[model samples]
Structures are given as structure tokens and as C-alpha cells.
Target: MADLSIDFVGIKSPNPFWLASAPPTDKAYNVERAFEAGWGGVVWKTLGEDPAAVNVSSRYSAIYDSYGEVSGFNNIELITDRSLEVNLREIEAVKKSWPDRALVVSLMVPCEEQAWKTIVKEVEKTGADGLELNFGCPHGMPERGMGAAVGQVPEYVEQVARWCKMYCKMPVIVKLTPNITDIRFPARAAKRGGADAVSLINTINSITGIDLDNMVARPIVDGKSTHGGYCGPAVKPIALSMTSEIARDPETMGLPISGIGGISNWRDAAEFISLGAGCVQVCTAAMIYGFRIVEEMKTGLANWMDSKGFETIEDFRGLAVPNTTDWKYLNMNYKVVASIDEDKCIGCGRCYIGCEDTSHQAIDLKPQADGTNKFEIIEEECVGCNLCQITCPVDDCITMERRDVGQPYMNWTQDPRNPHREVTEESTHEA
Candidate 1:
């Protein structure tokens, strides 16, 4: 049997799926419901000192797909609007009742060492499993010089992380901001400051949409709007790329990652784990579908693990990292051409139009005897870009067939067309 449990940086959980700090984990009621619904843990919404954040009435908006589904979600909401005493009391009660589940308290405070020191001590008294330093909130908190403001500066990230570790006995996981140019810098700094692990990515800065009549960005408040953090299925690709970068980078290798951003299903969680994340966090999905979504996530992941002959999460975790390499190292001699299954073709000609107008003109349309159009791929001209296949209406109608060119494996560095080919010591000696 496959085991979904994980002990991330010594914080034990029933499974790897933990709820990221957000509205879903805002209070004891929500956290308790999430635990009852099968979530392994919850990173309690970011706790701050008194004078809590007062959010706007309209706090969220979403970008929708053609099918009217939410492709991306945006939020301008700040940290916990509740007072510190209220939040701390709830956190302690929840952790006490749910002793087996991981309860990590997400926290944000002023950059001052004393602020961090004081907050860490108070959170420790709650008997939570760990702390996720909330340095990733992009919109409201940054204006006060706390969230992305601290995350964007490597020195500040390190200094604050150090302060937390110095005063707190529990493990500290730094939640990183995605608004930076390079994620590795802050990740490396967190490690330098002795962080136990790191979680990402917070959210990409974005404006969901604009109301033409009002001329304001989405989730408008009193006829105005500000940029907010973006997440959901649309941001998954960006999140994956950033996660892989931190995983493979030598400076931050082996640092435990609690993957966040657009992780809706088990496959998304699997992808994050394969790229070196020890556990995965969900926020937008739970917000959209409610807590019961974790049931499908757990079932799907276990089924996948069993199919792969794996007994535990560790068996396949980080297994894909080595294969995720740079394009420069890719085999240039490998050839694949598009193959259209004529029998299954619906003659929609969507593939032909897509290829002709936007992509390579490799798909040719012809009037068939049955008075319908037949689309065929020009094998020689097809570069296997998969654009045509993606536009095809029928599933598996068009496939990329690998050509057995009998050519040896060659990368751009070894190719004759490369003007700036890498020169080895042997080449230097010959020259």
C-alpha cells in the first residue's frame, strides 16, 4: 500500500497536502473543518500584532477561461484582520484538539528583531508544530514594508529568519515572494539564516480584469482598484518553473519546499513533489471548491503511487529533477514529425487554420470524396511543434511520431552550426 504521510522538516502530517495560509485557514472554525474534511494540516493565516488589517468589501476577482471556468484568481486582501490575541487563542485551541495533524502558524511582523522575537515567543506558547514566516503577501502588507518588501531584499529575509530562529525553538519555514527577479537569491539567503525549510511561491502580481465602464481594475473598491496577488490553474506553469529552479540550483539544493500556487489536484501535487518539494500546499482550490476537494486529491495520489509500484511518497519524490535539464543540453538530433490519423479526423479544419495562420503551414486541407475536408500533415515541413495537434478537436487524432534518423546523440555544444560551441580542454590543446 502507498503511504501519503510525510514528516517535513520534523513536522509530521497524515499526508503531504497542507492548506496554505489564506482565507480558508483564517480561524479555528475553518481550520477545524478543513482537518475534518481530510486535510493533512493548515498553515494558519498570517498572524500580526494588534491593529489588524481592515480589508476592502470587494476583495477578490477571477480571470475565466472560454468555458467560464476560473483560470486564475486574484485577491487584494491583506493578512489576518483579527487581533493577535484572538488568532493566537484560536490557534492554540485548534492545535490542542487536532494533535495528530500538523499546525504551522504563518506569521508577519515588523522587520525589527524585537518584533520577530516577541511574536515568535507568543506563537511558540500555542504548541503549534512550526512557523511559516509570511514574507510573500504581495499587495496590502508590502505597502506597510512587511511582506514582499522584506522578501525582495535577501539581507532582510536572512536577518528576519535569523531573528525567528534565534528566539524560537520550533522549525521555521520562510514563505518566499514570487515578485522578485530571481527566487534563488532569497532561498539561498533563507538557508544562510538557518531556516528549516521554505515554501513558495506566494502569488504573481496581477490585475485580474478591468471594468470598461468604470475604467477600474477588477475587484474594484469604491470605483478604484489596486494590483493584487494572482493564483489558480493559470499560474501553475510559472510556479513549476520557479520550483524546479530552486530545487536544482546548487545554492539551495536539498532545502525542503512546501509547494504553493495553483495546486488544485493530485497531479499538481505530484509534480511539485517530483521537483523536490517535501509537501504541497493548496489555497485557491480550497477557496473555490471548499474543503472536500482534498478527498479526491488524496485518492488520486495514492492510486497513482500504487500504479507506479511505489510504497511511499519518497519513492517518486524528486525523481524527475535530474531529467529536468536545460535546453542547451537537449539532444538536437532527435526528430519527431506530426502524424494525423485520417480515420479519426472530424474534418473540422481547426488544425489546418491554426497551423496556417499562427504556426508552420504543415497541415494541408483537401476536399475529400465525401464532400468534407481532409487535413493531412506535411511530414517534411512539420517541426513537431504540436500546435496543430493542440488545436485538433479529436483526441489522439494527431500524434508526434519519432523518426529513427540513426544519428548519434548530439547537443548544441557539439553541433557544427553552433558558432559559439563550448571548447573543451582537448579543443584548446589542439588549437
Candidate 2:
């Protein structure tokens, strides 16, 4: 088996799958069970001053199909409901008992240097390995100017990060919020403040649906509802894009990333690694399936790594970065037209119907003398937009064939239909 172990900012874990700071990691009991179930690390749920922090009952809501399959989760929950002293005591006990596991404590508090200083000392005394500044919780905390509030302001992010770095003995990982316009801003800001690493994609603000019966919004609490954070498979694409943006940015490229949001399997984990995430975080999937899912994540990832001959995470990390670039850098001359393999086509006519009605009449469906139908692409009329490829249900039935750039010529540069082109008299004179 290939080595699945990873070292993120001096904290070593036997594998890259670390449970995100959520309900599962709220206490020692849950964390110990996760460790036994093969999770490399757990970020203890966000801890803060207990005197002021109070949580509501019925802190979570879910979207279900008619059959009641959870498609999304909505949480009105704030940080950990447990008292600070109790959480610290549990952390101390868990760390002492499971010294080999990666134990990171998540913290959220008033954006004050004194408050940070006091808490860091208390958390450090618990003998935890590291700390994650919970700047991503979109609900409850934001109302009090805590979670997403500090995260939205890049200056506050840097300021808080600096305080943690200065006062805390443990490595500080800034867990970022996804609500900001550009993820790189806070990422860079955290780096400026001496953050050791950054974890991302806390949650996106969302209203799942409406309660038609009550004539009110969903996840209704006391006949009122505020937008809660959204997380699940739905947020994976957004999370992946944000993670890639920060990883590829030169200003913050070297900073380690803990990829979070919508990761459910080994393939998802591999995608984050290829895009430069040092390790991956999980919450929604684990919550839905339970801790035992880590067993399959670890096994599946290890098997895939061995098959691909990747001896370490660094072997394939950021391998896809070089291929990602701006639109201008994309080769305009490159071309690919959808080609359907006759043998693989099931005569579903899905491609034909889709193309005939909505796209260019590029596909010709012909019935042979033997009463068999086949679909072929009109090479000349095929614009290579790939609509047929997308509509095809069978994988590899339709493939895009790249056309060689015979000459450095582009129709877009000279097309009169292009809105960007100016019909100037000087160009007319040349014409």
C-alpha cells in the first residue's frame, strides 16, 4: 500500500482525512469514536467564553425527498453548547489518552486581543496539537459579529490570526468563510498575519426551501427564519474552485490548505489533493453516514494511490495546477467535435433529439438495410460545442476529437458577429 500519511504544518496525521469541526467533534466521546473508526484527526468544535454563549433547541433542519433522503442540512446551531471549562477538560483527557492522533481545537470569540490571549493559554494547557480559528460559521455567530463577520473583513481576519500566532503556542490554522466574493483576500490576509495554514469553505448562506403549509420560510424557528449555512455535495464545486484559486495564487501559494465542504469519497479527496489541498476535511457526509465511512475513505484512497504509483500525497499534489489558466491563455485554435461510436450507441436518440431541437443539426441518424439505426456527426457542420457529448447517457459513446491548428488562425478575431469587434474606418480601409 502507498503511504496515505500527511504532514500539514508540522502536525502529522496517519492519513489526510480529518473530520471538520462540527457536531461530530464537539466532545471527546465522539472524537475517540472517530479515532477508533480510522480518522487521522478531529478539529474540536468551536469553543468560546461559556458565560455568554447559549444555544437553542432544535438547532438543525434537513431537506428530504418524498422518501425522506436528506439532500441538505440547515443548522441554526451556534458554536459548541458545552462550557469552556468542560470542553478544555475533555480535550485534556482525549489528548492524553490518544497522544498519537492529531487533536486541533476550533475557537471563536470576540475579536479582541485579550480574549484571544486568554483562550489560547487555556487551550494550550490542554495539550492539543494545533488550533483552527473558526472564521467560517455563517449562522448564529455572524449575528454577534463573530464567525462570518470577522471573515468578511480581511483586516479582522489578519488581526485575529496575528493575535493567535503571537499568543498561542500551537500552530494556528485560519478556517475561512466562503461568503466573501473572493476567497484569496482572506487567505492572503491570514498569511500576512503569520497563520501556519488555512482551512476553507465554512458554509454558504442559503434558504433551502419554503414551508408552503405555514406560509413561511424553511427551517422555521418560532415562526421566523434566518438564512443558515449550506453544506453538502452541492457545495463541492464551489469549494473546489475556491481551493484552487488560493492554491494557485502566487501571493498565498505556499500556504497549506485544509480542503473542506462537500467531500464524501476518495475521488473527491483526490480532486482536492490534485488542486493543492494538503489535507481534506469532512463533515456533512460523515454526519449523514457516520464515522465508519472513514474506513472506506482510507482504504479506497490507499488502493487508488498504489494503483497510480503515488507513494506520497506530494507525489500528485498540485499536479493539475499548471493546466488551469485564464481565458485569454486558452488556445482558441484548438477544436473538438463530438464523435459517437456506433457500436456503443444504444439508439436512444437522446443525442439526436437534443441536437435537432436545441443545437445545430449536426447529427444524422440513419437506418441501415438491416433495420439498425446509427448516429453520425456531420464533420463540417459540427461546431464542437459538446452538447451531444453531455446529453449522451453512455460514457465514451460520444467523445470530443481535438482538431490540430494547421495555421495560427482564429475566426473569433475576424467575426463580424463578435460584439467586441469595432467596425472602424481604419480597419475598413485596410479591408
Candidate 3:
């Protein structure tokens, strides 16, 4: 069996799958159950001065597809509603019991140095493996100047991370909010503050949907609604892009990343790790399917690793980062044409309509002996955009085939079309 263990910023976990600091890790009961179900670690839900914070009923909303599956989720919930002392005691007990699994406490506090100093000391006494500063909660905490309010400002993120790093003895991981314009700024800020690693992204501020009948946003409480944090499968692309950005950024390169958002399966976990995430955190998937999902995640990842001849997670981790680059760095000379298998085409006309009306008119309609229209791609007109492949209902029926263009490597910067090019005799000869 391939070894699934990982040492993320010196915090070792049996695997890279940790429960995010959300309802799943809110208390010892859930954490204990999650550990039993094969999760490698848990970041205890964000804790603060608890007497002032309280949660409301009807705290969740979701967007469902035609099949009634949840594609996206929204939550108006706040952090740990239990008292500070109670949460600490539970965390201490859980850490004592689950000695092998990683237990990191998540904390949010008032924007004062002393407030952060006090909480860091209290959490350190719990013998937790590390601490995750919950600067990314997008909902209620911001109203009190705690969550996204602090996260949105790079200086505030840096200052608070510095405070935690100064006061806390354990490894500090700064959780970042995606609600900002440029994620790199905060990522760089966290690095400046001496954070051991960074976890992202918290949730996107969203209104899941509006109840047309009631004329209000979803998750209505007392017939009224408010914006909440949006997450789940729909956010995977956004999460992957941001993770890759930080991982590839020259300023934040080699900064360990704890990937979060829309990770529902082992494939998703592998994708995150390949894209420079040291470990991955899960919440919505567990909330939807339960902790046993970790079994599949572990098995699938281990099996895939074994097949790939990888002895450890580190071997494949960040392997894809180098391949991820800016648009300008893409191979402009490379070309691919879309190919449709006639035997597999169901004559759905989906690809034809999509290509003809919305995209390049590469697919042509042909009269068939059966009196049905057959779709074929025009080789000359096809740009290999793959819009037809994407719009096709059948899987593997349409695929992009790499064409041997036999052209030398060329890019916009070196192209003659670029008037601002720094032209030299050598460059002109190459062009």
C-alpha cells in the first residue's frame, strides 16, 4: 500500500484529508466520530469570546440541480456557539483521546492584540497540534469586525497573523477569504506575518437563490433572509484557480497550502494536492454524505498512488504547479481539432445546435438514410474550441485530437503582430 501520511508544515496527519472548521468540527463529539471514520485531522470550529455569539434557526440554504442534487450550499451560521471554556475543554479531551490524528484549533477574536494574545495562550494549553486563524468566515463574524472584515484588508490579515505568531507557540495557519479582489495580496501578507501554512478559501459571500413567491433570498428566517457564505461543488474551479495562483506566485511560492472548497471525492483531493496543496479540508461533502466518505477518499488515493509508483504523498504533491502558467506562456503553435465518433453519436443535435448557433459553425448537418440528421465537423472550419465537446450529451463521443501543426514555438511577445516587441537582429532572424 502507498503511504498516505503527510507532514504539512510539521503537523503530521495520517492522510491529507482534514475536516474544515465548520459544523462538522464544531465539538468533540463530531471530531471523535470523524476520526473514527478515517479522517486524518480536524480543525476545530472557529472559537471566540463565546458568550456574545449566538446562532439562529434556519441557517442553511442550497442550490439544487434538475435531479435535486445540491450543487451549491449557503449558510448563515456563525462559529462555535458554545462557551469558550466548554469548547476548550472538549478540544483538550479530544486531543488526548485521538493522539495520532491532527487536532488544530481555529480561532477568531476581536481585532485587539490582547484579545488574540489571550486566546492563543488558552488554545496552546489544550495541547492541540497547531492553530488555524479563522480570518475567512464570510458571514456573521464580519459584522463584529472579525472574519472577512479582517481578511479583506491585507494589512489587517498580516497584523493579526503576526500577533498570533508572536503569542502562540504552535504552528500557525492563516485561513484566507475568497471575498477579496486579488487573493495573492493576502497570501503574501500571511507569508510576511510568519504563518507556517495557508488554508483557503473560506466561503464566497452569496445569495443562493430567491424565493420568487416570497420575493426574498433563500434560508428565510421569519420571512426575511440575509447573504451567507456559499460553498460546495460549484466553487471547485474558483478554489483551484486561487490555490494555483498562490502556489505559483513568486512571492508565495513554496508556501504550503491547505486546499479547501468543493472537494467531494478522492479525485478532487488528488487534484488539489497535484496543484500544490499540501493537505485538503472538507466540509460540505461530509455534511451531505457523512464521514464514511473518507474511506473512499483514502482507498482511491492510495490505489491511484500505488499504480503511479508513488511511495508517498510528497512524491506527487505540487507536480502540476510547473505546468500551470499564465496565458502568455501557452503554446500558441499547438493546435487540436474536435473529433466526433459517428458510432457513438446519438443524433441528439446538441453539438450541432451549440456549434452552429453559439459557437464556430464547424459542425455540419448531413441527411441520413434513416431520415435523421447526422452531425459532422468541417475540418477546415473547426478551430478546435471544444465547445461542441462540452455541449455534447454523450461522454467520450466527442474528443479534442491534437493536430501536428509542425510549427516552431511562438508567443505573443515574440510575434510580429506585437508592435512593442524588442526587435534585435537575432530576434528578427528567429521570427
Candidate 4:
């Protein structure tokens, strides 16, 4: 089996899987259990100043499908309820007990330098491996001008990150908020502040649904519901896009990134690494399944790595970044035509319906002389958009074939077509 060990900012872990700063890492007992379950590290739940925060009893709600599958997760939950003293003690205890496992404490307080300075002094004394600044919580803390509120403002993100770097001796990771207009802004700011790494994304602001009969938002607290953070599988694409944006952007290029949000399995972890995340964090996935899910994550990643002949995680990390680029840079001359495997076609007509109505009229569907349905591609008319390939239910049934760009006959690039272009003899002599 391939080695699954990873080292992030000098903090070594048996694997790349770390629990996010959520319920799973709220207390010492919980974090210990996570480590025992095969997790390589745990970012203890967000802890703040002396005054403890109180959370609603029913702070969590679920968006379930007809099959009772959890399509999404909503939480009005705030940071840790425990005091700084309790959290530090637990961090110290856990670190001493499991010295090999990574123990990073997450913190969020007032953005002022004094507030950050005081907390960092105390947290560093605990001897935790690292620290993660909690700038992504989008719910209860935003009202205090913390969490997403601070994260949304690029200036505040930079200032707070700088404070952490100045005050803390350990590695500082800035956890980014997904509620912002553009994620690259905060990521770039964090890197400017000397952050060891950045982790994303915190939950997004959302109201899952209202109880129509009672006319109430979800997780009704005191007969009223405010917007909570949304997570789960639904947010994976959003998280991936933001991570890829930060990874590929010129401003924050080469910065270490920790991927979070909707990471449920080894495949998802591999995708995150391929997209430039050095490590992967999990919360909702472990909450949905048990902590034992890490066992599968470890084994699966190891097995896949072995099969691919990758000796270590770094071999495959950021393997896909070079292929990602802006749309304007794309070569318009490149083209692809759709091809269908006759034996593999399920005849679901989904591609036909999608292409015939919504997309470019690329597919030709008609009845054969033998009273059988036949689907063919109109090569001349096909724009090669690949909508049919996406809509096809069967795998490999519809494939896109790349068309070679032929020599241009229009001569648009020639001097004749340009205003600055002098009408040369060849242009003037042409009919």
C-alpha cells in the first residue's frame, strides 16, 4: 500500500484527513474518539474569549429527500460553548496524550489586535500543533462583526491574519468564508498576512425551507428562525470552484490550501488534492456517517495510490491545476463532435430531448425503416457543445470527438482585414 502520511506546515499526521472545527471536535472526549477512529488530526471547535456562548437546543435542521437521504444540513450553531480555559486545558491534555496526532485549535474573537493578542498568548501556551483562525462561520457570530462579517471585508481579513501571525508562534491557518463575492480576495489577503496555510470554505448562508403549515423557517428557535449556515453534498461544487479559483489565481498562486466542505470519502479527498488542496477537512460527512468513515477513507486512498504507483500524496497533489484556465484563453478553433456507441445506447431519449429543445440542434433522431429508433449526429450542424454527452444516461454511450482545426480560407488575420492594414497589392488585385 502507498504511504498516506502527510505533513502540513511542519505538523505531521498519519493521513490527510482532519476533522473540521465543528461538533466532532467540540470537546476532548470527542476529539480523542476521532483520533481513535483513524483521523490524522482534528481542529478543535472554535473557542473565543472568557464569556461562554450559549447555543439553542434545536440549532440543527435537516433537508431530507423522499428517500430520507440528507440532501443538505443547516445549523444555527455558533462557536464553542466552553470557555477559553476549558478549551486550552483540553487541547493541552489531547496534545500530551496523542503527540503524534495533529491538534490545531480554532479561534474567533473580536478583530482588535489586543483581543487577538491576548487569546493567542493563552492558546499558544497549550502547546497545540497549530492554530486556525475562524473567519468562516456565517451565522450567530456575524452579528458581532466576527466570522463571516470580518471575512467579507478584505481589510479585516488581512488585519486579523496579520495579528495572528504576529502574536502566535505556531502555524496560523486562515479559514475562509464562502459567503463573500469572490473567495480569492480573502485568500490573497491571508497570504499577504504571512499565513502558513488557508482552509475553506465555511458554511454558506441559507434558509433551507419554511414549514408551510406553520409558516416558519427551519430549526424553529423560540417560534422564530433566522438564516443558518448550509452544508452537505449540495455545497461541494461551490466549494470546489472557490478552492480552484484561489489555487489558480495569480495573486494567491502557490499558497498552501486545505479543502473543506462536503468532503465525504476518499474520492472526494483525492479530488481536492488534485485541485491543489494540500490536506482535506471533514465535518458533515463524519456527522452523517460515523467517525469510522475515516477507516474507509484511509484504506481507499492508500489502495488507489498503490494502484496508480504514487509513492506519496505529493506525487498526485495539484496534478490538475495546469489544465485549468480562464475561458478567454481557451482556443475557439478547437472543436469536438459527438459520437454514440450503438450497443451502449439505452435509447432513453434524454440526449434527444436536451439537444432538440434546449441546446444547439446537434442530435438527429428518427425512426428506422425497420420500425426501430435511431439516433445519429448531424455533423455539419453539430456545434460540439457536449450537452448530449452530459444528458446521456449510459456511460460512454455518447462521446465527444475532437475535430482538427483546418487551414483558414477567410484570411481575417491578414493586413486586408485591418484598418491599420495597408491595402497591399494582393488585397487590391483580389476580386
Write model 3 residue lDDT over 300-394, tens digit each, in one string. Answer: 99999999999999999999998887765466777998899999999999999988898889989998898998888898899889899988889
Taking all chains together, each candidate's TM-score versus the true structure is 0.97, 0.91, 0.97, 0.91
* lDDT pick, better of 1 and 2: 1
Residue pairs of candidate 1 with colliding backbone atoms: none
lDDT of every predicted structure (CA atoms): 0.92, 0.88, 0.92, 0.88
Candidate 4, lDDT over the whole model: 0.88
**Which lDDT tens digits does candidate 2 get at residues 146-217?**
999999999999999999999977899999999999999999999999999999889888888878888766
Better of 2 and 4 by lDDT: 4
Predicted candidate 1 versus true structure: per-residue lDDT over 311-421, tens digit per residue: 889899899889887776678778999999989988888899989998889988899798999887888888889898888879999999999889877777667899999
Q: Which portions of model 2 show Cα errors greater than 4 Å?
A: 63-71, 367-373, 408-431
Clashes in model 4: which pairs? Answer: none
Model 3 gets an lDDT of 0.92
Task: Residues 1-431, candidate 4: write the lDDT tens digits.
Answer: 79889999888899999999999899999999998999999999999987988899688888887799887899999999988888899899999999999899899998899999999889899889899999999998999989999989888889998998898889999999999889999999999988999999999999999989899998898789999999887789898999899889989988999999889889999999999998999999899898999999999999999999998999999988877766533444567899988899867788889999998787788887887778989888888988999988898999999888793322222334355645445433312
Model 4: residues >4 Å from true position, as ranges?
64-67, 368-372, 407-431
Steric clash count of candidate 3: 0
User: Which portions of model 1 show Cα errors greater than 4 Å?
Assistant: 425-431
